[model samples]
Target: MVDADQTFVIVGGGLAGAKAAEALRAEGFTGRVILICDERDHPYARPALSKGYLLGKEERESVFVHEPAWYARNDIELHLGQTVVAIDRAAKSVRYGDDGTVVHYDKLLLATGAEPRRLDIPGTGLAGVHHLRRLAHAERLKGMLTALGRDNGHLVIAGAGWIGLEVAAAAREYGAEVTVVEPAESPLHGVLGPELGNVYAELHREHGVRFHFGARLTEIVGQDGMVLAARTDDGEEHPAHDVLAAIGAAPRTSLAEAAGLEIADRAHGGGIAVDERLRTSDPDIHAAGDVASFPHALFGTRLRVEHWANALNGGPAAARAMLGKEVLYDRVPYFFSDQYDVGMEYSGWAPPGSYDQVVLRGDAGKRQFIAFWLKEGRVLAGMNVNVWDVTGPIQDLIRRGTPVDTEALADPRVPLGELAGRD
Candidate 1:
C-alpha cells in the first residue's frame, strides 16, 4: 500500500489518465492523486465523438467519463487546462507551462496519448479541410456538415482508417456525397489484410461511398480560403467541398522526450518503450495508453495499438504497477468500429505473414459474419461484422490459444462457444 500522503501525478486527462485515476481510487490507494489535463472540460469519452456523437445520436454531456462532483467526492484533484511542460526526474517533480509551477510526485503516469497526423500537402490549411482527433475537432466538423446542407456538398475523406470511415458514414447519414481516398488496394488493407478489407470496400461501395483505391493524393486545392478539390498522383482530380484527413496519428511523446526519457523508435512512428509491466526506462516513470510501445505476447514483438480498449486496459495496468503491484499486461488486443449501420469488432493479434488459414462463418453479403484468422492450427485473431456476440467466444479461444476444427468454425449452426470444448 502506498503512503496516505504519497502524491501521484497523472499527465493527460484522456480516458487513459482518467480511468487510471478512477481505478486507483477504486483499488483503495487513497493518496493525493492529481489529474493534469490541458483541456478545460472534465474528462470525456472520445470513441463516440467519431460516430454517435458526430451523428447526433448521442449527447455530448453523455460522453463524460465522470461528473465534476464525482471527482471531488473521490478526493481526486483535477488540474484542468494545465499543461505539463517537462518532467524533472532528479527532482521527482513535473514543471507546468511557462510559469514552471512544479508538482512533486512519488510516482508519475504518462498517458499523454496521441494527436491526429496532418497532411503536408498544399491547401491542407484551407478552412474546409480538417482532422478529427478531439471533441472540438468533431464539433467543428459537425457544424460544417450542418452548414453544407448534406445533399448539396461533397465530403472527401483522405484516409480509409476507422475514423475516416466513421466520418464517412456520419456524412452519408446526413445525405452528403461522400468519397474516401485510400492509397491501399482496399480499405483497412494495412490492418485487416487484402481479403477482409475487400469486404469493407464492398460494404462502403454498396452504401454509395466512392473509393479511390491505390490512389495517392498529390495536393488539396482550394478556392479562396476554403477547400475545393483534391488532385491525385495519377492526375485525377475530385471535386470536394470538405476534406477530412484520417491518415492516422502520432504519439504525443515530446514532453516525455524532453524529460530525458528514452523514446522507442517505431517503424510507423515513435513511441515510448516500456517493459511488460508498462514501466519505462525509468522505473519511477511509467507510460501507458497510446504513447507506449508494449510487448505483444501473441506477436512476439513490441507494438503500439491506438484504440479505446488499449487505453482503458493499459492505463489501469500501469496504475496497478505504480502501486507496487506486479502484473503482466498480455491480454488480447480488441477494437471496434461503426459505419453504415454495421458494427465491426476484432480481437487477438494478427502478425504479418503468420496467418495461413481464414475460416468464414455466415455470409459476408448479408453483413453478419465472423472471420477467424488461423496461423498453423491455432487461432491468431478474429474479425466480426455485425456480430458482436461471436466475438466474446472467439476472443476467449484466441486467448486460450486453442485449436479448433476449421470445418466446425465455418459452420454457422455450430455455436462458437462450443469451439473451446473441441480442443
Candidate 2:
C-alpha cells in the first residue's frame, strides 16, 4: 500500500503525466507527486497546436491542462524544463537535468510521449523548415503562418497524415498556398483507405489545398539557410517559402530502452511495453500515453495510440493501476481532427488490411458521413465526418465484435446503438 512517505514520480509534462498526477491525488493517494517535463511550458493539450492555436482562434492559455497555481495548491511538485537523463531502476530513482539531481520514487510512471519524426534529407536544418510537436514549435509556426499568409507565400508540407492535413487546412485558412506531398495514393490512405480518403482529398482541394500523391519528399531545397522549395522523388520541385515535415512521430523510448525496460517491437507501434494494467516488466514502473504499447483486449492486438483521447484517458488508467487498483486499459483507440470545415472523430483500430469492407452512411459528397471499417461484417473502426453524437454507439459496436447486417449498418434509419445491441 502506498503511504504518505512514498513518492510517485511522473516523467513527461504532457496530458498523460498531468492527468496521472491529477488522478493520483483524486484517488486519495497522499504520497508526494512529482511531474518532470523537459519543456518549459506547463502541461498542455497538443491538438490546438495544429488547429485553434495555429489558426490564432484560441488563446495561448487555453491549451494548458491546469492553471499555474493548481500544481502548487495540490502539493504536486512541478519540474518544468527539466529532462530526466537516466533512470536508475535498481535505486528506484531517476537522474534528471544537467546537475544530475536524483529523485527517488516508490512507483514511477513514464509518459515521455513521442517526438515528430525528423526529415533525414538535405536542407532540413534550413530556417524555414519546421515541424509541429511542442508548444514552442507551434508558437513559431503560428507566427510564420501569419507572415506567410500576409506575404501570400507557398508552404509545402510533407505527408498527408492528420497533422499535415490539419496544418494544410490552417495554412489555407490563413490565405497561404499549401501543397501536400504524400507517398500514399490518397490523403489519410493508411487510416481511412481510398474510399474515405478521397473525401478528404476533395475537401482540401475545394479549399485550395493542392495534393501531390504517390511520391515521397526527398529533399528540402534551400538557399542561404532558408527553404526555397521541396523536391520529391517524382522529379518535381514545388516552390515553397516554408516546409512543414509532418511525416509522423516516433515514440520517445530512449530513456526506457537505456533503462533496460521492455520495449515493444515496431510491429506493435514501438514504445515501452506494458500489460493491460499498464505495468511494465518492472512491477514498480508503469508506462502510458504515446510512450506505452499495451495489449488491447477488444482489438485483440497490441496498440500504441498517440492521439489526444488516448493520453487523456490512459494517464488516469495507469495511475489507478499504480494505486494497485484493478485496471483493464482496453479503451477503444480514438482520435479527432479539424481540417478546413470538416471535423471528424475516429474510434477503434482498423488499419489497412485489417478490415475487408468499408460501409458508408449518410452522404460523402456533402461531407456528412460515417465510414465503418468492418472485418467479416464485424465493425472494427468507424469515423464520422461532419457528423455528431455517435462516438459512443460506434465504439460499442466495435467492442461487441459481433457480425452485423451491412445493410442495417449502412442504413441511416437503423440506429447504431441498436446494431450494437446496446438498447
Candidate 3:
C-alpha cells in the first residue's frame, strides 16, 4: 500500500504519463503526483499531429490531453520543459538536464517515450531536413507546408511507414508535390506485408503521390545550407525543397539503463524490460509506454509498442501496479491510421510469419475490407480498412483465441459480432 504521504513521480509527459497521473488521483491516492515533461506544453494526443492538427482541422488547444487548468484543478504538479539528465535510483531522485533542478520521489514511473531515428547520410543536418516526433516538429512541418503550398515546394519523404504516409497525405493536402522513397517494394511492407501494402501503394498513386521503391537514400544534397534534393543508391537524384525523415523512432532508455534497470536487446526492440505488472528491476520503480519492453500476456512474447493505445492503457495499469494492485496488462494491442480516403483499425499482434494466410471480407481494391490474419484457422489479428464500428468485435476475437470459419468471415452478410462470442 502507498504511504499516502510520499510523492509519486512520473517521467515523460506524453499520454502515458498523463494517464498515469490521472490513475493515481482516480485511485484515491492523496499523495503528490509530479509529472515531468520535456515538452513545454501539457500532455496532448500525438496521433492528431499527423492528421487533424497537421491539416489545421483542429485547433492547437484541442490537441492537449487535458488543458493546463485541469492539471492544477486535479492537484497534479506539472514540470514542463524540464529535460532529465539522469536518474539516481539509490538516492530516489532525478537530475534535471544541465540546469540542475533535482526532484525526489518515493515511487518512480518512467514514461520517457521515443525519439525519431536519424539518417546517417550526409547533409541530413541541413536547414530544411527534418524529422517529426513532437509538437514542435509538427509546428515546423505545418509552417513548411504553408511555405511549400504557396511556393509549390517539393517535399521528399525518406520512408513509407505510417508517419511518412500520413505526412505525405497532409503535405499533399497543403498542395505540396510529394515524392516518397522506400527501401522496400511498397509502403508499409514490413507492417502489412506486400499484398496489403500494395493496396496502400495504389492508394497513394491515385492521389498523385510518386513512390521510388527499392531505393536506398544515400545522401541529402543541399545548397546554400538548405535541402535541395535526396540522392538514392540507384544513381537517381530526386529534387526537393525539404526532406522529412520518417524512418522510425528509438525508445529513450538511457536513464533506465543508467539506473541499472534491465533492458532488452536490439533484436527485442531495445527497451527497458518490465514484467507483466509493468514493474522494472527495482521494486519501487515501474516503466510504461514506448520505452517499456513488457511481456505481453496474450502473445506470450516480450514486445514494446509505440502506438497511442498502448500508452493510453498501459499507463493506468502501471499506476495500479505501483499501488499494490493486481495488474495483468493483457490488453489486445490496437492501432489506427488515416491516409487519403482510407481509415484503418487493427487489433492484436501479427508477428512475422505467425499468420499463414490473409482472409478478406469486402474488397481491398474498393478500400472497404476487413483483413484477418489467421494462424491455423485461429484469428491472430484483424484489420478493418475504410470500415468503421467493428474494433470491439475484432479485439474480442483475438482475446477469445477461438478458431474462426474463414467462409463466414469472408461473407459480408454474416455479422462481425457473431464471429466473436466474447463481445
Candidate 4:
C-alpha cells in the first residue's frame, strides 16, 4: 500500500505517465512522484506530431501536456532528456544512463510507449529519410516539407498506416507530390478493412496522391547522402525528396523484460503482460500504455493498444491500481485520426475478421458515414468518418453488448441514441 512517505517512480514522460502522476496528486496521495523522460521536451500530446503540428497548423509549445512551471508547481520531479538504462527489481531501484544514478521506488510504473518500426532496406540510413515519433523528428520533417514545397518536390511514403497517410495529407497540403507504397490492396486495410480502406484510398487519389499497392520497397535511391528516388518490386521508380517509414510501431518493452516482468508472446501483441488492473507479475511493479498488454474482458483476449485514448484512460486506472484501489480498467478502447477533410473516430475492438460484416449508415462516396462491425446481429465495434456527434451512441451499443436491428442501424434518419435505447 502506498503511504505519504513512499516514492512513486514513473518511467515514461508521455501522456500516460503525466496523467498517472496527476491522478496520484488529485487523489491526495502526497507521495513523492518522480517522472523520468528520455525526451528533452516536457510531456506532450504525441498524436499531434502527425497532424496539426507536422502541418505547421499548431505551435510546438501548444502540444506540451504541461508548461515547464506546472511540473515544479506540482512538486513532481521531472527528469528530461535522461534515459533509464536498467531496472533492478530486487533492489527496487532503476539505473540511469551513463552516469548510472539509481532511483529507488516503493512502486514503479512503466509507461514507456512504442516506437516506429524501421525498415532494413538499403539506403534507409540516407539523409532526408525520417520517422515521426518525437518532437525533434517533427521539427526536422517540417523544415524538409517546407523546402520540398518550395521546390515542388515529391515524397515517397514507405507505408500506408495512419501515420503515413496523415503525413501524406500534410505533405500534399504543402503542395508536394506524395506517393504511398503499400503491400496491401488498400490503405488501412489491416485496421478498417478493405471497404473503409478503399474510402481512404480514393480520398487520397482524389486529392492528387499516387499509390503503388501490392508492391515491396526494393531500395531507397540516394546521392550525396540525400534521397532522390525509391524503387519498388514492380520496377517503378518514384521521386523521393523525402521518405517516411510509418510501417508500424513496436512496444518499448526492453526494460520490462530486463526487470523480469512477464512478456506477452503474441505475434502482434508483444509487451509486458499485466492483469486487468494493470499490475505486472511483480507485485511492486505496474505496466501501462503501449508497453503493457492486459486482458480485455470485452475482447476475451490479451490486448495492447497504441493510441491516445488508451494511454489517457489507462494511466489513471493504473495509478489507482498502484495505490491498492479497485481498478478493472474496463473502458472500451477509442481513437481518432484527422487526414485532409476526413475526421474519423473508432471505438471498441473488431478483432480482424471477427465481425461478420460491416453496416454503413451514411454515404462513403460523400466521405460521411458510420460503419458498425456486427457479429451475429450484435454490434461489436463502430466507426464514424466525417460524421458528427454520434460516438456516444456508437460506444454505448458496443459497451452494453445489446443486439440491434440491422435495417434501423443502416438508416441515417433514425437517431443513433434511439436505437441504443438512450432516448
C-alpha local distance difference test of each model: 0.86, 0.94, 0.90, 0.90
Sequence-dependent TM-score of model 4? 0.98
lDDT of 3: 0.90
Q: How would the candidate models be sorted by lDDT, starting from the highest?
A: 2, 3, 4, 1
Per-residue lDDT, model 4, residue 320, is 88
Write one digit per residue (lDDT tens) for candidate 2, span 113-177.
Answer: 99999989998999999999999999999999999999999999999999999999999988999
- List runs of model 4 lying over 4 Å from the truth: none
TM-score of candidate 3 relative to the true fold: 0.98
* Ten contiguous residues with the weakest lDDT in model 4: 259-268
Candidate achieving the largest TM-score: 2
lDDT tens digits by residue: candidate 4, 75-168: 9999999999999999999998669999899999999999989988899999988999988989998998898888999999989989999999
Residues 296-381, model 3: lDDT tens digits: 76777888999999999999999999899999988888899988778999888886577898899999889999999888888888
> How close is each model in CA RMSD to the real structure?
1.6, 0.7, 1.2, 1.1
Least accurate stretch of 10 residues (summed lDDT) in model 1? 143-152
Candidate 1 residues 1-423, lDDT tens each?
598989999998998999999889988897899999998888887898898999998998888888889999999989888899889999999988568889899999999999998888888889889898888898998988776654579888989988988888888777788889999888887778876888888878887899998887789889889878998888989999999999999999999888888788876347998889999889999998889887877667787888899888998999999999988988788899988778988888774466888888888888898888898778989989987666678877797675778898899888888886633
Query: If scored against the real structure, what TM-score would every candidate get?
Result: 0.96, 0.99, 0.98, 0.98
> After best superposition, candidate 3 residue 323: deviation in angstroms?
1.0
| Best-performing candidate as measured by lDDT | 2
> What stretches of model 2 exceed 4 Å from their correct place?
none
